[model samples]
Target: MQRNQIIRTRLGWTLLDGVERLVSALWPARFKGSVGRVLLLPAVLLIGILVIGLGYMIEYSFHELDLSTYRLKDEYSLVNYAVIADRPVYMRVLNRTLLAALIVSVTTVFLAFPYAYMLVRTRSALTRKFLLIALFLPFFIGQVVRAYGWLIILGKQGLINSLLEGLGLPTLNLIYNYPSVIFGLIQYMLPFAILLIVPAVAAISEDVELASEGLGANWISTFRYIVLPLARPGLIGAFVVVFTLTLTDFAMPEILGGGTTDFIASAIYDSFFQLSNAGLGAALSMILVMIGSVIVAAIFYLAGTGTLGVREQSR
Candidate 1:
């Protein structure tokens, strides 16, 4: 009986020891995590600053204003929002903004993808270096300068028209419309998309290509199935970059859109500068903020849920 008691006691001690070890592992003896010192803290601070700015804008958007004093009036009113809601012109401008964003984004990706592919796949070192430098060259120049360069190229009687006329062909009017805005936007945003996609294309394994070849797959088939799937993150990233830039870009649309092709940004500028309507301008800015918020939220949700894998499967 004494021996039985000792064995039971030893087993109980062993069980208790294991429980203690597990508890220690799960909840450490020392709490080492500094929540304030997390890597995301700086990002949180930056986001907080932006949120505060947006909050102030939202607050300003809700009030009436006295243009003489340049101060807000008492009593919150929805008059600004009502003005936007009643105006078909505002809605048209919003639609134009979305359409231009879509066009520029799609064009940028389509053009950049092949160029980036060649940059990575080509074996020529000088060619690769030159392409990279050329891609980044526009960024070194200011946006205003680049826009002016496009103005020179696409303006009435510009180089393209001159060339066509020299060839005895009728001159085409490409500027002062949607096409000019899209052209300038693509030129401005292409670098971002190319940079985002090139790394993914470069990172593709040679062994994977070889394996696909061994399976009787041709180059096209291999690229379609094996390569695209692996590079999906980069592609998605590029699309997001292009889409967001085109959606928010003010310079291209302002300079190239002319009066008839007024977008939300141009509308906001007109309200502020021409009309001197700060409240109205704030309201328009708020509207853009809401639209941008929706887009960003949708992108985040799609990225979080991994629904962006459609890019590879569609191919």
Candidate 2:
């Protein structure tokens, strides 16, 4: 029995060795460091698709749409871009989008920081769990659903108005305005800002804050000096994300702005679908992309590459 067992073990070892040799032969030393590259293949493919789509858009932008035939002109020109430059409505929409983006980014960050700080610094497990639930609950709900929910709550004959009527107060006009759009955007973006900031806040050492307190620094002082500087990367990241998203937002402006406070996205939609002007829409899209890229580049330049986790080497 022992001899039979020993023979079986030797056979197993031989099979394993052969399998290893086969794997090594199939995957040579030159390809050993390619696992990460393999993992990145899907992302590269996605980016390639995006680039191809952008190329089509660029081509479309160069051609004028024939209103009579509802087709693009054979010749390429800058007539679509020229219309945007000459039209005041396009510039107005662009300006509104930019302003909304700035407001939403700043407001979201300000509101999110305190919530994130509490979530990270709380000693009670229940409080932490509650905070996490509140933060993530909105994420599961679709943005359109939430936007509609706001319409229900803030509509002229909605809950708030009903309550005001009960109390003999005038019903306020809450929805379908620029403020309402900004309000909805801030609500939608708050969770994202908190999520980005929490990691940065958690990375801060409790001992550092305690030491600052021991050295006679007040809580406000410690927070302002220590926490703010350390958590800047997350703040900048959240700001960039919120700003870009708000800048290109379609739903909030469409649903809440009620066509009166049209953003650039609304104009783009009208150009493509409502007006059947693909060339104009493509030009607007390219402009939006350029504006977003420039703003993001400016942020990286002003805030440094640290926001992207690339630290500068010491001199």
Candidate 3:
């Protein structure tokens, strides 16, 4: 540590320090927070624009579609919300979306945890590189392409079917079902779950774990009490991400569902594009956003925001 400090002193980074001075001089001490607020203007501006768009959509959701005029009615009513409430199809689709999101989030987290643990804990550079490569290779392919790839592999007369035919055996039907849609969601979500979890696992000190073991804690006990609690933040974060993405996903379910299953996103598409019911589509979109917001709020209420790296008063 002493030697490293000496090296740091020898390389004083004079040019970078001069640039820092130049920047500091540009924003005088009297205008400190003002300059920082100016720098934040673009992001705040974009958020304001988004809030405005949401306002428009909220207005749209309350208006009725005038089919004769092929435009939204200027008069506002509770018709859209009433339709959503009275229609059982909307509830069914919403429930299916919620179920799928829940299952995909849980399954992806379960599969990702061990992978993240191994990736973070391993010391070998080559092993880490290899794992990273394997994990990211699928990302180069687009989600639609990946879903279609599953179709080709899981369809009749595909690779597995061909193998079964060669073996003079019956082939299994694989794709285009509720489970198949969930499988695709799981595949798409696994890497994201692992990426979110790695930081949490990495934050844990191996020395602390070792000390626990030294105190006569078994592997299961240590994991249940120490690792799980410490990693709850990341786990909840991954759950929220995967759940929202799956809840709003259009492509995977649309491609893999074989017309037998439909998530709420697909229903929204049908409402707007296929049926030309813009009012209903707006209502559905708002519903989707509300559902997502509620889930995130519930997660925060239960787990707090430490998973998101917010400053803790105690920490």
Best candidate according to lDDT: 2
lDDT of 1 by residue, 133-201 (tens): 999898899888888788788778889989998999998878788888888888888899999888777
Question: Which regions of candidate 1 deviate over 4 angstroms?
Answer: 1-44, 67-70, 164-170, 303-315
TM-score sort, best first = 2, 3, 1
lDDT value, candidate 2, whole model: 0.93
Winner on TM-score (1 vs 3): 3
TM-score of each: 0.79, 0.89, 0.88
Better of 2 and 3 by TM-score: 2
For model 3, the local distance difference test gives 0.89
Query: What would the per-residue lDDT of candidate 3 be over residues 1-315, giving only the tens digit for each residue?
Result: 999988787677766788789988986778876877899999999999999999988988998988898788999998988999999999999999999999999999999999998898899999899889978988898899999999998888788888898999999888778999999999999999999998888888998789889999999999998898888888888998999999999999999897777999999999899988888999999999999999899988878667655656332
Model 3 steric clash total: 0
Once model 1 is optimally superposed onto the true structure by TM-score, how far is the C-alpha of residue 212 displaced, in angstroms?
Answer: 1.8
Clashing pairs in model 3, backbone N/Cα/C closer than 3 A: none
Candidates' C-alpha lDDT:
0.83, 0.93, 0.89
Q: Which candidate ranks first by TM-score, i.e. highest?
A: 2
Alpha carbon lDDT of residue 286, candidate 1? 92
Model 2 CA deviation exceeding 4 Å by range: 1-30, 312-315
Clashes of each: 0, 0, 0
